[model samples]
Target chain A: MSKHLKHLLTYVVALLLFVFMGYPFLYMISTSFKSLESFFIEPFAILSWPLNFSNYTEVFTMGLGRYFMNSIIISVTAVTLVVLVAALASYPISRLKFKMNRPLFLLFIAGMMLPIHATLIPIFVLTQNLGIYDSLLALLGPYIAFALPISIFILTQFMQEVPKELEEAAMIDGCGHIRIFWNIMVPMTIPAISTIVIYNFIHIWTEFIFALVLISSPGNMTLPLGLQRFYDEFSVNVPALMAALTLASMPILLVYIFAQEKVVKGLAGGAVKG
Target chain B: MQTVSPVKTSKHLEIKKKKKKWKHTFTICMFIAPALFIYGLYVLYPILSTFQLSLSSWDGNPAGPTFIGLDNYIRLLSDPIFFKALRNNILVVLTSVFIQIPLGLILALLLFAPLKGLRVFSTVYFMPFLMSTVAIGLLWIFIFDPINGPLNKFIQTLGMKPVAWLGSPDTAMFSVLLVIVWQFAPFYMILFKAAMVGIPDELYESASIDGATGVKKFIYITLPLLIPTMVTSSILAIVGSLKQFDLFYIMTGGGPSNATELMGTYMYKNAFLSFNMGYASTIAFTMFLIAFIVTVIIQVLEYYRRKKGVFS
Candidate 1:
């Protein structure tokens, strides 16, 4: 084939792929800007004139803000805890020579394939017994627990690559394991740490089933649960629901837009390493 | 006198070595304790609890469980819905591995083509994956809306009747399967893209010198190199398919006469909606077992394949 023909073919295929992957999102954002009458009249139109901004303002009033805040608080807290604990555990697992090192690493790695459903009922019961059900606190345990396997996996993989000499030199300076981990290992593993943070943050931010099971109150619900509630309460008012979705998805989108390379790498890093 | 001095020094060094080893073990324990405790409580213990619960009947009440000794499993063998759900779960696994992975590879290859506006094309292609499953489910619900959705409107434009995409049993699974492909194909795209970048440019250069065409080079070189990634992607898709809940739960709730019932959705309904926690545990444990068995089988196969030097 001629080079020009090949180029044209590439563009054609790219456009079709774009529509398949992206058109739904476009329709969503477009519909969010349509009034009910306009939506009913020209629901399939890519864009409607006399754009409606009411849906955007209305979703916030319907407690999207509360869900947003709850999600941020929970995700930040859980990601922080996961990073710290996973990193601490990764140091010994990756660097130290314990009898259980290989077995322990495999044990944690096995959690990646384990279904959350298996543990769902017991977790629900445990949360209730702890008197923390229906609140943000109920989510923390599972979020951190679920995030650990991958976090430890990624951190240990990266830690294994860090030169042993750096930590050994620190030890020679009379620095204890804690001191070396804090000063040497943590600094060296910042790239991996950031990947874990982004990966877990996205997972926790949009985590659904756990929130659906544990959290009941609107005020305590995360973004995914809150979005589900919006769907239930306002099934007829799709414009408003789309607006809520657009808002709920904004933070991740914006993060991706700004840090495209890092976001892609971070999201793919865990699976790619395997 | 010399022998006695040497023995004393050696004995002292042995005692010191034992003390150092004890301290090293203590430090390792301290580091591992927090993660192990949380992982054990929430993950390890819950898995055992699910297995134990699967043996009995319970209503998720304070009255406690009654040990029925695998009655739930016995009932599961006869339940039509459970069988339907298991079959649907397998459908999801097949769709993910067969359709989604190939589609993802196509998109990833498109991104590497020498085309203008590459950034725009790549960005839009990845947009579906960045949205939360809840958001994606809700968005697609509107898109598949029987009356006002663009899909039916487009169908009407084609001079055909508007179909109830999600409302009909025949189409619900297909509709959701399309959405799953859309949501996850980008993930595999990035995975393939990362792997593709690791393929050395020198190999392609050598192929060019050998008078190799694009397709030939891809077949002989690129495809062979991507086998590891393909294996990893298949494993992820299969395990992921078994555990998928949010999309199906939000989209159809496994309805339209159970046409789209997956094990995850079925288990959710049993536990929360119907309050049959024990049967739910039974389904949930079975999902774990399937995933575990599949993972182990894949690992063993991959190990033996590597041992036999199949790919390398």
Candidate 2:
């Protein structure tokens, strides 16, 4: 094929793949605005005129808003805890000379491969025994633990690349390890830290199995769990379920759009390295 | 005016050194303690306990588990459903390795050559990976809906009979696998793309000069250079497929007569539905063992390859 033809072919192929990949999302957005009757009648239509806003409204009335809030809280808390703890743990392992640093780092790395299923029963029993069962707090411990491995792995690698001269200069000025870490290290590792924060936030936001097993009460259900329950209760209400799915996915999608570079680079970095 | 004795000065130096050493250890401990505590409690401890749980029977009650001593494993060997689930998991792994990774590599290769509007295409391809699995599962469930779903509608437009994609046992696993590939292929694409971008342009330029261009150049240059990435990514795909839960669970619930049962969903049902904690733990442990063994084999293979200077 001619060069121009090949380029055109590539674009055509890419566009076809794009359409294949994007169709569901576009269909989803359109369906959320569609009425149940229209959805049944014209399911394959790209658009439905006289869009129904009632599905969106009905989702909130059916307690999607509560689930949304619950997700936000749990995700935010988990991300914050993971980032903070991971950063703290990573600093000494990355910079300071210590006897057990390598072993400790490896310990965290080992945690990465742990199947969440293996820990599910024990975590369930532990949370119940600790009296945090059926509460949002029950999720925090596991989320932070699972989040630690990758966060620590990434942060430690990032922190190691940080110039040691800065820390040495801070030490010369009588700054302690904690002060130096807070001032020099944290600011310098912001990229990695933000990546950790975003990944953890996204992971915890959509995490379901733990939430399903741990939280019994509907009052504390996160978006994924709540959506599952909602689907079960209203299995036939396609439009409403679409609306809820869209709602559940909207924030992260928006974040991905705006912070596309950071999210992609960060995730690729973590995945490749970890 | 301030001439001190040698012993006094040496004593003062010793005290300062001791204090600094203690302070250094304290700082290290303080920095690491919180993470260690939480990780130990939630991750490490639970992992060890899972092994114990696997060897015993329990109903998840307060009465505590009783030692059954390998009964769960023995029973699992006899269980048909467990074998079915294992087959499904292996099928997922095989499909991911043979199908998803290669497709992802093709897409990545297509997009690798600098082209206009590729960024937008890349984002579109990757959007599914970022979306929640539950949402993806629900979306596919709607798409596969026999009566009102677009997939069936499209089939009907193609002059074919509309089929119940997820509702039928024969097609259910395939449908779920399709969704899995849809959501995850982009991940491997990004991974391969990253590795491909790192290949210096001069190599390709030289290859073309030698009249080894196009697929020939790719086979000789790009494919060999991408081996390490391929190894890592394939391992990722394998482990991920084995541990997959959310998509299958939400979409099919291993349903239509256990046609889509995976180790994950099987273990989940055994634990939560059947309340057979012991057997559930065995399944979970088996999952861990499989993942662990696969990972170790990959690492060992990578080690040997590196030793042979295969991709250095």
Candidate 3:
């Protein structure tokens, strides 16, 4: 009898948690399917028939596509650069026995705690001096630099666990360091590489402060900035704003749905050891 | 196979070895240069520049800055809003450590319960963590809307008056902190879940054989074993709390009379809104110092804890 009571109690708690966490998402998506008049009249409805699609059309027409494209360009470019550069740096730090290896690795790992606000003013000033203050190109430098620490840390940890015999054998066969790095270390660290790619891609995709400070042009605004501006411009249009948010959030949600385990592991990679 | 003289061959081998060492050193430097250059130019240099700017009085003009050594810091000592923001930031740290961490452990435990539809429960629980902070903030604003929001609607159903959750000073900080907890608890859930997975099954089995109940096993086995992860989660919470900006900026902009202002939003207001770059740099530098000091303290405490555990 007590076992049955415990089972019932578990379901009750689970149900309450599910409601707390999931209702807002359900409401947002549901409200996006309602017209303005319907939303005002029946704000608590669960998206019944005669569903409205105009909110999606209206939000898309209002320059959300530009923000999406900008986010894609910046996130992809920055992730690619960070992966390649971090891998090259991690190769020597993890594999070689040079005197500066440990200190260099520590320098990069220490960056994980450095707040971006500390760098914002100087980076803003530097971008202005470089004449790329409002351009999409302005974000690449900070994005790649800030991403290096965690990427290099993850890559080096994974690389240290890689077996050394094959690389030593390759070295004996007169293969150069570049060749061994490309052929051996890069191939071996694919899991860590993927972790960093997913990790950095998500962060850069939603990055706000740097873009908010450096990029002022409407055309160059990333998704987060564009979304905030859109809300400010049309604060009363709740349905349209929900539509915009739903669209803005689709990519990451889809990625999580399809690759749930990978996303979870990638996100927790910073705080937990695999 | 060589017929050459031994002395000449040995001398020739030494020259070759020297050349190889030089090549190796060059390769190492080449591999590290790009990452170092970018990190230095963007992160390291900016930190020093922020410190330098904090010592000056610059309104971000075309003309050079006026160096008023330590004036910004001196003024910051008496700034009321700065202290309020600091107090709010500490509140977030306390909320994250006490509320979010325990709530996360509960949610993670729920996922492990012998119940139905756990997959569905976990998926929804983690949904908030996956969305952008801006999106989450916007969604919650409507949910807290006084006239048309669901929370007020539910209150009306209870025959109570509607409250302006984000508009009033009394509830503004609590409302935003609630949303923050909702958004972040799942993250700690995953962290705890990962750590729980690492606990050996043999321990649980042995506990069961010794006639231990579920609560007893949890207290003796699970809680003590989660100490390291708890420390890590606390550090993440504290550091993350200090750097928080986006959600508060979107939800309240530190408004309703500065009730929700954080150092991040305060710094942004000074730098971008007012162009008080010098003062903003002071706030930013102070943020960096607080985070650095807190991290060092936690690590030292952890080191001693581990040492005591080893001896005992």
Candidate 4:
């Protein structure tokens, strides 16, 4: 094939794959705007013009708004708690000389291999015993715990590479370990911290099994659980369901778009290194 | 008097040093305490307790569990559904390792070439990985919906009968796998692409100069250089496949006579749906053991390969 023809072929192939990959998302967005009649009548059409906005409104009226707020609260709290705890714990393991540092770090690292299902029953029991069952508080502990391994791993690796000279200089000025950690270490590891925040946010936002198992109250249900419930309850309402899915996914999708580079790099870094 | 004073000074200095050491240890503990506490309470405790629970019969109630020794394990070994779930999980692992990774690698290679608008294509391809798996599951569910779904509509247009993609036992597993691949192949693609980008351009240039172009150059240079990444991604894919719960759970609920029941969903059903906590724990423990074993095998293989200087 001629070079130009070959390039055109590549473009054609790329476009085909792009459509194959992206059509679902596009179909979702288009369908959300579509009326039920249009959806049923012309299912494969990319878009039915004269967009119906009622699906978006209907989703809000159908308790999606409550689920959205619940998700935001849980995800934000979990991310904050995980980032703070992981950063604090990672600093000592990464920088200080402690006898149990390696073992402690390994302990957290081993948590990565732990499948959440293995711990589900015990956690469910523990939450009930602790009187946090059927509440949002029940999720916080597990979310932070599950997020620790990767957060600590990434933070510690990043922290270890932080120039020791800065810490030494701080010490020369009579700064204590805590002060140095707060001032020098935290600011320097912002990239890693942001990565942790983004990751934990997305994770806790979408986490379902735990949410489903733990929180039984309809009022306390997170987005995924809420969406699942909505799907079950309104099995036939494709347009409204699509709208809810779109709404549920929008926040994280926006976050990913805004911080695409950091998200990608962070994920890539964590995966490759870990 | 001078000798006595000198001994007193030494004792004073020793006490000060001891206090300083104590202070340092206290600071270290303070830094580590919060994470350790949460991790211990939530992660470590549950893991140990799950093992304990696996050995006993319980209804997930406040009442204590009854010790049943190895009965749960024996039951799991004999259970047909457990075996079915296990089969599904193994199939997922195989498909992920054999299919997803290779497909991802091929896509990565395609994008690695200096194609125009590659960035746009890359972003579009990776968009699915950014969305929640639940959302992806719902999206696929819509796509496979028997009546108004796009897939069936397309089939009808092609002059064929519309299949109930997720409703049939025969096609359910395949449908679930298709969604899995669609959702995750881009992730592996990005990983492989990152690894490929790191390969020195001069290697490709050198190969092309030797009249080895396209397939030959890729086979000799790109493929070999990407092995480390392939190995890592394959391990990731396999482990991920083994533990997959959300997509299948949300999509099929391991349904149509449990044709798509994975180990994760099976354990979940036993614990939550049936309230067979003991049996569920046994399944969970077994899942953990398999994950651990798979990881160890991969690590051992990686070790041998590294020892042989297969990786740079």
In order, what fnat does every candidate score? 0.91, 0.75, 0.74, 0.71
DockQ for each numbered candidate: 0.89, 0.74, 0.81, 0.74
Q: What is the TM-score of chain B in candidate 2?
A: 0.91
Per-residue lDDT over B189-269 for candidate 3, one digit per residue giving the tens place of the 0 to 100 score: 999999899899999999999999898999999998888888889999998998999999999999889999999999999
Over the stretch A1-274, how does candidate 3's per-residue lDDT look in tens digits? 4988888988998898899999999989999999999999999988756999999999988999999999999999999999999999999999987899999999898888888899999999999999999999999999999999999999999999989898899989999889999999999989899899989998898888899988998899999999999999998899999999999999999999999999999999898753
**A94-182 per-residue lDDT for model 2 (tens digits):** 99997999999999987767679999999999998999999999999999999999899999999999998999999999999999999
TM-score per model for chain B alone?
Answer: 0.96, 0.91, 0.94, 0.93
B212-278, model 2: which lDDT tens digit per residue? 8588988999999998888878878887788899999999999989999999999999999999999
TM-score (C-alpha, index-matched) for candidate 3: 0.97
Interface RMSD of 4: 1.3
Per-residue lDDT tens digits of candidate 4, residues B1-312? 667789889899999999998998899999999999999998888888989999999986768899999999998889999999999999998889888888788678777767877888877888887778888898899899998788998889899999999999999999999988888888888788788878898998988889996878878998888888888888788878888999999999999999999999999999999999998999999999988898788879888888998774
The runs of at least 3 residues in candidate 4 whose Cα sits more than 4 Å from the true structure, single-residue gaps closed, are A1-5, B1-13
CAPRI quality level assigned to candidate 4 from its DockQ score? medium
What is the alpha-carbon lDDT of model 1 when measured against the actual structure?
0.93
Model 4 C-alpha lDDT per residue in residues A1-274, reported as the tens digit of each score: 6888877887787778888889999989999999899888887777788889999999999999999999999988899989889999999899999699999999898777778898999899889889999999999999999999989999999999999999999999999989998999999999889878877777788898899899998899999999988988997889999999999888977877787777667666557642
Candidate 1 chain B weakest lDDT stretch, 10 residues: B1-10
Clashes of each: 0, 0, 0, 0
Pairwise TM-score winner, candidates 3 and 4: 3
